[model samples]
Target chain A: MASKRIGKQTVKIESPVSIAATAAIAGPKEGDGPLRLYFDMIIEDEMWGEKSWEKAESKIVKETFSRLLSKADKTTGEIDYVIAGDLLNQCIAANFGLRDSEIPFFGVFGACSTIAESMQLGTMLIDGGYADNVVALTSSHFCSAEKQFRFPLELGTQRPPTSQWTVTGSGAVLLTNQGSGPYITYLTTGKIVDMGIKDANNMGAAMAPAAVDTIATHFKDTGLPIDYYDLIVTGDLGLVGKTICADLLKRHGFDISDRYNDCGVMIFDCKRQDVHSGGSGCACSATVFAGFIYQEMMKGNLNRVLFVPTGALMSTTSTQQGESIPAIAHAVSVERDLSS
Target chain B: MYNIMTKKEYEKYAEKIAPKSNIVRNTARAFVVGGLICVVGQIITNFLKSKGYDMDDTSNLTALIMILIGIIFTGLNVYDELGRFAGAGSIVPITGFANSIVSPAMEFKSEGFIMGVGAKMFVIAGPVLVYGISASVVIGIIYYLLNF
Candidate 1:
């Protein structure tokens, strides 16, 4: 009845993308040694005012890529290319930061899912023999972003508990034709999805429909059961978004309960952090992918990851013109190559 | 297993990390001061209600009051103490944003708007508000594209 009512066929798997390296920067305390990220690019929230968003983003990206590229150990003159994007306009933050570095670069955007989309594109590019090394990048700035879209930070607006934090950081991942690492196994193309949620302050409710679409597509294309991957991760659907996505999938007869989780909600343990539902932004998934999950993968605690990066494709202009939020999500599965 | 901290060890860690006596007293003081902030908010809400403002307006008015309180606490060096005790409960949302705005506004009073108060104000809350508004608007458009 619902399928007939919606009148849309389910989506299927198209291709997959690989992940190379992931890195994040955040504030630091010496006691946070075990949990300390390599770059303690701690910009206190108060100090993060409007201008700082772009500055911090540029700095994080520039520093991170510079460090990663410098360490790439280019024996042959075959240096890797960089594919990057951000939430900022024209991917300006990434463009400005990555410009100085001699990496062959192209900019892309997938909203919060920019990192995953870039990764998918990078992998496809490499697989197609277009390029061997590619880097995907993304970032979010709380102040400049707010002023451009909604009210200014000075408005001191209140947020609902269902809201997710927009991480004030940037992340970069380097993909290459390497010897040993996780390979991009498959990816499901995303379609625009919207379920009539209009309130700009409430995002989890907004992105849920896209999450449902991509997750369902992954199942259809791969013909793989939910249990196939060790963990099925969703990009920035927070607590509320995750719940809605799960319900929508269950209705489609593919249960993703046990293996399903969202990056937004997984970051700060909302109750402890008062981050409401969880974390959001390009950095939301990027930081977690680089920080916690990367460590786990390195330690061999888990392997074979199916990551579906979800994006909400809308801007302030479209909203002001009375448009609904259209969302897209790309699914990329990564697993350690046995040859390594 | 020896490397891993046990429940007992965690308990000890928590105790060791617990706020000291002076810190607890200061936090209590800060909470009392913070509670006064709510009192001010209530007074504003009541005053707005008396003027026949709607609940939404009154609530918004309360939020503004809270931000002002956050600024005062921060200036007085009491906001950090309040944060230690209330954890994110005190600092996460409104108060947190309040700290973000006022701290800079107070820091670079000379730089005025672009460089100082106006420019640096949104550093912390900017991303939250941006994603909040952007996500909301995007979802709205998706709804329209799929429907209207």
Candidate 2:
């Protein structure tokens, strides 16, 4: 029998899916960060010999996917689906990178929350017995994201202090039905929440409300205490959004300050790195989890973690048309299967 | 236990949390950089004049030289660094315009000359050219009609 559904927004997977292997690749800037040692490959060149930043991003995705498959000792033929996305328009990086793979691809878009979104779908597919193995991945490049969303690098637009740098990295996780376990057990899908924030520079402010709403709903649905998990990690709230999220959660009678951490904050030393608030991108959370967090879990340092990746959904066209940023967050609970 | 906020209230909170801007610093940088670029043009114009060129001819020669410098810097990948440092200072000049055109062209040169360099060379500066030429034509027609 499948595990019972907890509440309206949460799912409890009956058969927990294991992450067989994972790989993370980042550009030089991310390599210089505090989490540098955790990443598998840190290419010195941002372009990675590609002609354009967009093409470079595609290379990052392809390299990460290939690395994950190799680590797991599985061919692309063994994988049932390649579930991925990127911050690029139409997720061009994933589409172009995986075009030659010939695997069944499901391209998704949840902005920066794509990692968790893809993982949720991948986990569901495996737990439902629809696929034996699936690979979930996402990527984002700073230059490419800047070109698409803001002014070109040649324009030299000054970034606001509230602005977070988009991480130039890709992370891929190979999920299998059976493995030495750090199993995905539950997931909570988030709603699109908007607080009418119009500024594109302040993504953390736009996305925090959605993250708070999702976390609160997740706790209520699972009937779990704040300490149920060792850590509750947010995708890329950075400094600004993390503070706002804490305050909002406190008002809701839950204090998650001690247990809470954000991938954006974890990925970089904001002050020293000149990243201002922190890092923000689809790759931000993906690389952090695949590199640092997963390794920690494997070493028995952490038992359970609730990973919530948040995203601010706003296109340049929408923002130019005076539309407010709407945000979403998706949560996945990964537990170390000690019994197995 | 969640306390829901109205859109207005949330916006107010968001505004308070937004980063403060240092307009004085930004403006100073822009002014210095922009002035320096103009000074370079002026120096070039003066040099051409000293070499016996007329005022109109000197101005055209100065623009061409500046654009050539911009293209060289872009090819060497140095213009983007200058842009990073100067912000709008490096961008509000003819050299900046030249950099914009040459940079994308060089970047896409690998995708083959026709579809890549030829097609995408104006990806960044295409709109500027279109509007600039159209506006100039409109202004010239208006001035002629009024003067006539």
Winner by lDDT: 2
DockQ list for all candidates: 0.03, 0.38
TM-score of each: 0.67, 0.90
Give DockQ: model 1: 0.03
For residues A226-338, write the lDDT of model 2, one tens digit per residue.
99889999999988899899888998987999999999999999989889889999999999999998999999998899999999999999998999999999999989973
What class would a CAPRI assessor give candidate 2's docking? acceptable
Estimate, for each residue in A189-269, the C-alpha lDDT of model 1 and write its tens digit. 677776555555556667776777777766765677788777888888887778767766786786788888888877656
lDDT tens digits, residue span B1-148, model 2: 2447898998888778767867788778878988998998999998999999998899899999999988888777788877766778888899989988887777666668999789978987999999999999999999999999
iRMS (Å) per candidate: 16.0, 2.9
Q: Can you tell me the CAPRI class of model 1?
A: incorrect
Q: Give me the displacement of residue B20 in model 2, in angstroms.
A: 2.1
Off by over 4 Å in 1: A1-20, A27-51, A74-78, A338-340, B1-148
Q: Pairs clashing in candidate 2?
A: none
Candidate 1: residue A340 lDDT (0-100) = 29
